[model samples]
Target chain A: MKRKEQKTFIAAFLLPPLLLYALFVLWPAVNAFRYSLTRWDGLGSATWVGLYNFRNILARSSEFMPALEHNVFLMVVPGIITLSLALFFAYVIHQRIRGARLFRIAFFFPNIISSVAVALLWVLIYSASDVGLLNNLLRLINPKHEMIAFAESSRLLWALVPMIVWSGTGFYMVLFLAAMENIPDSFYEAARLDGAGSFALFRKVTLPLMWDVLTTGIIFLVIGGLKIFDVIWVMENGRPTTTTHTMATLMYSKVFEEYNIGYGTAIAVLLFILVLLATMVSFRLLRRERLEY
Target chain B: MQRMLGGAGSGLKYAILVLYLLAVVFPMVWVLYTSAKSTQEIYQNPFGLPAAVTAPSAKTLETPIENFEKAWVGSHFSSYFVNSVKLVSISLVLILLLGAMAAYVLARFEFRGKGLVYYLFLSGLLIPMQLILIPLFFQFSDMGEALTRLLGPITERLGLGYLTVSLHDSHPGLILIYVAASLPFTVFVLTSFFRTLPGELREAAMIDGASEYRIFFSVMMPLGKPGLVTVAIFNFLGLWNEYLFGLVFLNSDHLKTLPLGLASISMQAQYKSDFGLLFAGLVIAMVPTLLVYMFLQERLTKGITVGALKG
Candidate 1:
């Protein structure tokens, strides 16, 4: 009876937070799931479309598969490069080398920036004109080939690629850096004396141990990759045949701009499921007993 | 021989680090330079330094005077700014105070459905903002309309002219969204900070007859300064650059925040590129964040690493 009463007592204190959170977040979350089932605009009756909304995106829309391919391509190449760079930078800094604090701050500053702002900056950088940063730099060095950063569709892809990679490397660096610091130094010291060189030491020790954090980073990048709407949305606003379009931007264009609520919700719901599945998989596979060493 | 190679390798490593740093920092410097230059000169020489800061000098600056002045004076940018500051400040303070208090209750005291409550908050961290935006907008609209209707009847009953409460464009409306979006991470972050506090510290305070409120306000609040600073800065930047919600919520031209304001006014000529005004506006819009970052440079790193990584 005492235990039950104590539980009730604690429940009273926890009530307010739970109520507010559910009312705002959980309620909306239910609405998101529900709305995905219905064909609704910003107004009017939501028709019960059943599995059609899901089916439309999965099997119907022409942009669906190509955009998925683009998002997946975005996820793998830049994702792997940035994660490895972050891990490397973190490892170096965690070694307590000189100017570690400064390096960390310089790297992590980009995380605070809005993706819209970064997109704006990178647009200028990749401008097809000679005023663009990369083309000018290229002109300055070689003065040959007049590299078209944003002229051709393929060129635009290559142009925006650097911005995506450049902006995100710092965020993952901070994550891995933290994980590295949490690893016991005694293990590192012992590994050092065992005649393990830098790459060998990292491969055997750091990567295996920080696997949990790495998986977490990968999952984050995957979801983040799929949700690549805002930056792309700001730059060109899903323009020129929608070649650069991802699922997120496609949803936005169809729904808000084109007023295709049914199709947009269909895409948004697909992204949510795909992201959710990726996160669940990462969590399931990567979790292990906490090896506190 | 291996030692010699290791020495060369370390030297190469330094070279790579310097190259990486230059790559990141160079574009930022270009922004600073471009912000000072005139449009005429930008076309002729993209790489030249600014001859003057403001005009009427040896060299002229060539952005539209109207845009910068418009941002500062014409538009209620000052008012919109205050709205943003007040919204962020009030929301963060409330979240920190209430969040830390609730975190204390969860961490120190025995609680029912605690794990469930914890996961309830944790699940929020996974939810990206794009998903729930539609439902939230509907809720906000409904609440706003309901408040307006209530205010109308009350005013009429008193025989006064009806002054409808337009909660839609009000400061409180923005604050509501900010709080909802920010509370999850703030709670997660402060909970960790709270758990690190020694249990005896609070218990001993309790023996001294300190109330829960007092223990929280007096003891826990002050010690959690670092964590508070971290959360505060993150909240500041997040709210500052937040456009999607701001775009949806704020409709009046006079009520526009910096980001939306810049986005609307800066681009012209039927999409004719005005890199000059755009860069100037971008620089101006980016200033508060840059300044905040420069100040919280070290603390921000520690906070994000600790706050975000554990999840």
Candidate 2:
């Protein structure tokens, strides 16, 4: 091919995707910053209030504070449980336990279900009515037991812990399992010869070996926790209360429902900043001396 | 003493694993059987077998069929399913083709600003979609008005009716966002994938007098199947279950995708206390991806591992 023709080919190949990406993604992203600084209802002429929205969000009485706290709770509570369970499962499965494949496949089932569907499934499970699974089980144990409204907004955050762990543990297990499988059996044998117990062997041999993937998994969990929306939205019936709102849900309601476009976009901006900082901080904290086999 | 301790530990491990397995699998099983019962029957025997299974009668057997019927047609889950299929399929095709083209050029070809262009796409990995959501909502309105202005005179001159172009509340609008939003990860993954392919194949094809386009179409694309499949599955899952974008962009009842439709139905079901329809709807929303996962579990796991490790 001629040099000119090669240039033409490259132009043709790259331009469409680049153009589309810039138009829809990059352009809006830049505009989000500009929108954040102004007061606009999304329909009328806008007034630039320059950081007032940010100030409002940062106020002690602002809804954003509680929402941020909920995000943290979701992140820390479920995040810790999911990681521990995944690591345990991955290590056991890595040891070639019976039905490892079945466990891996079945545990991953909930992860593939749509979050809305998962939330609905859990709603049925948590219902206070006669059809509620958990309540029914409680009734089985004690016929006089009162039903609990597990999906109610006041209790929704705690209710979400099991659901998040249930859905998330599988993916991390598979991730850590893949990393564990990459470690040669020779490493385990060497550790065993050194008189390392099973627990010690896993600690010394497996965890450090899969540190990079573990870091990746933590980052995924943090970002997922920060951006939780669908399940909360579905569970709260699309009207998440101040008690139950995450940053993403709050942003949605502020903008779409209340037409506080500037304030909502500002929340989104702060959410982005939170995600960026969380990723960086996790990377920094989780960065150990990379262990190689 | 040591051996007995080890035995207890192993038993505990099995117990925990089995318990978790039941916890995960039982809810789904419950949903399945619960869907086969009427709302009244469900209240009576939440944990028991539906009458259809325990003691089948003509009327009892109709319960399962009727639930599915009410969900699939009455609640418009069938429409939602079809919309999801159409939207996801079209977006997948465009994402693959465009992603491959850009990734191929960036990976195989040496050009000025190559690093800059590649990094620009990579930067998208850090962008939260929420940051762009608000601006894009308004931008669509602006774009629609501008497009209508541009085409209004031309259409008028051509004797066509007055033309209006809107990106809101339409499938095309959502498809555009899905394709564009998906590209960053797609390009990042496929670029690395393309680089690993033998360069000699492209050179060999070129020596045979094939044009660049022909080489890409005939030689490169066929070889890119494994990479394409991985990208396709990842994007398919992401876009298929995508909720936030669909919720914002698609408002019309008929135009809503599965997740949106499922969400709306769930709210209504709660209000109506219609557990059967909700369970049936949940099954409708879940079964396709579940079926696909059954067939492609290995590939799907491999894809996630590779993506996680690489990204």
Candidate 3:
């Protein structure tokens, strides 16, 4: 192909997608910063408020702080539960247990459904009414037992612990399993011959080899935890109180519901920074020299 | 030959796997059954059959699909279902076409600023959509109004009605955002995929006097089917289940997607004793995904692992 022709082809191929991406994603991302700085309600023109919005959100108000705390709790709690369960399941499945394929498929079932559906399913289970599955089970176990209002705003975060873990473990399990599969059979064989027990072989060989993938999984968990909205949004019936609000939900409700565009974008800006920092910090804290076989 | 792990260890493994599997699947199964039950039966026999045993041999049974009927026809999930299908399919097509075009270029050519442009797309993978949501709404609406003004005369002449392109609260607008949001990951996956294909195929096609466009459409695309399918399935499922963008950008009731519709139904279920209807809605929202997973389980798992592992 001629040099000029090649250039034109590249230009033609790249321009449309890049243009759409910039207009929708990149440009708006930059605009998020500008909007965060102004006092606009997303309608009439706004005055520049400088750092007032950020200061008010980060310092002045108790609301944003509690929301941030909830986000952190969500990140740490579900992150621990999901990763541990995923790692354990991945290891056991890696053992080629009976019906391992069926187990793998079943474990990943929740990942196939939408987040909203998962939340709704859990809500039904946790409902305090006669139709509620958990409540019904409790009622059957003991006649004196009362139905728990598990879906209330105050208790929603605790409720979300199991919901998030249940849906998330399979994806990470598949992730770690894929990584584990890449380790040579010779390594495991060598370890076994050296009298390394099952746990020892996993610890000595599997863990180090799969560190990169595990880091990626952790990063995925952290980012996902921080941005969580749908589960809390649906489970709370789209009316998140202070007790249940995460940063993403708070940002959405503030901007769209309250029309506080500036304040909401401020939350967005903080969320962006927080995700970046958490990802970076996780990578740093988990970093080790890679071991090659 | 299998090495002998103790029977105790094997039993423990089976026990753990079965336990977790039950924990995972029981909710969905329970919801399926509950969706079939009448409201009264739901209250009386929460975990039992949908029929009441009035005598030793005779039982009264309610139609299992009553809840589905109520949620679909009565509650208007049918319309929302159509809207979701429209949005997801249109977005899937655009993402694949545009994503393939860009991925092909990035994989095959050496151009100035290629590295920078590649990283630009890569950076998008990390940036949260939450940051862009506020500005995106306003921008789309403004663009819609501008397009309406620009195309007003032509559209009127063409009998396309007041043909304006205001994307806000419309199918096209939602599709545009979905395509953009999915592009980064799609491009990343496909570019790596394209690079792995031997260049000799393109060289062979060039010797036959095939134009670049022909090369792309006929040769490259066919060769890249697995990668394309993987990316397409991932994007399709993601867009189908997407709630945040649809919830915020679309305001009209009829324009809402399944996730948004299900959410609205859930909120309304708070005051209404429509748990059966809600369960039916859950099952409706879930069927397509479950069906896709059942048939394409390999592709779905492989697609996810491909993207995550590559990252």
Candidate 1, B1-311: lDDT as tens digits:
12222467667766776777887888878876786655655777887775565344632533445445544665445665666666677888777765665676777776557787787888888776767666676777777688778888888889997766655666677776677777788888878888888888877997998866677779988988887877776676777777777766788877777766655644341165556656666667667777878976777777766666755
Q: Write the per-residue lDDT of candidate 2 for residues B1-311, one digit (tens) a residue.
A: 12222578888998999999999999998998899999999887789999999999998999999999999999999999999999999999999999999999999999999999999999898999999999999999999999999998899899997799999999999999999999999999999999999989988988998999999999889999999998998899889999999999999999999999999999998889988899999888888988999999999988877876766
Ranking by lDDT: 2, 3, 1
Q: Which stretches of candidate 1 lie above 4 Å from their native place? A: A1-16, A95-101, A144-156, A238-241, A287-290, B1-5, B53-83, B163-170, B269-272
Candidate 1 per-residue C-alpha lDDT over A1-293 given as tens digits, one digit per residue, 9 for 90 to 100? 65675465456556666677777777877777777787777678778898887787777757788788778888888888888788878887776666777787787777777776687777777766646887888788897757575734555555556777788889899888778767777776788889888888789888888888888788888998888766665665435345777887777677767766666766766777788898998788777665655
Q: Which candidate number maximizes lDDT?
A: 2
Show the colliding residue pairs in model 1.
none
lDDT, residue A154, candidate 2: 92
The DockQ of each candidate is: 0.44, 0.73, 0.82
Model 3 clash pairs are B144-B166
Q: For model 3, how does the per-residue alpha-carbon lDDT over B131-161 read when each residue is reduced to its tens digit?
A: 9988898888788888889999788989978
Interface RMSD of each: 2.9, 1.9, 1.1
lDDT of each: 0.72, 0.92, 0.87
Best by DockQ: 3
Error of 1 at B247 (Å): 2.9
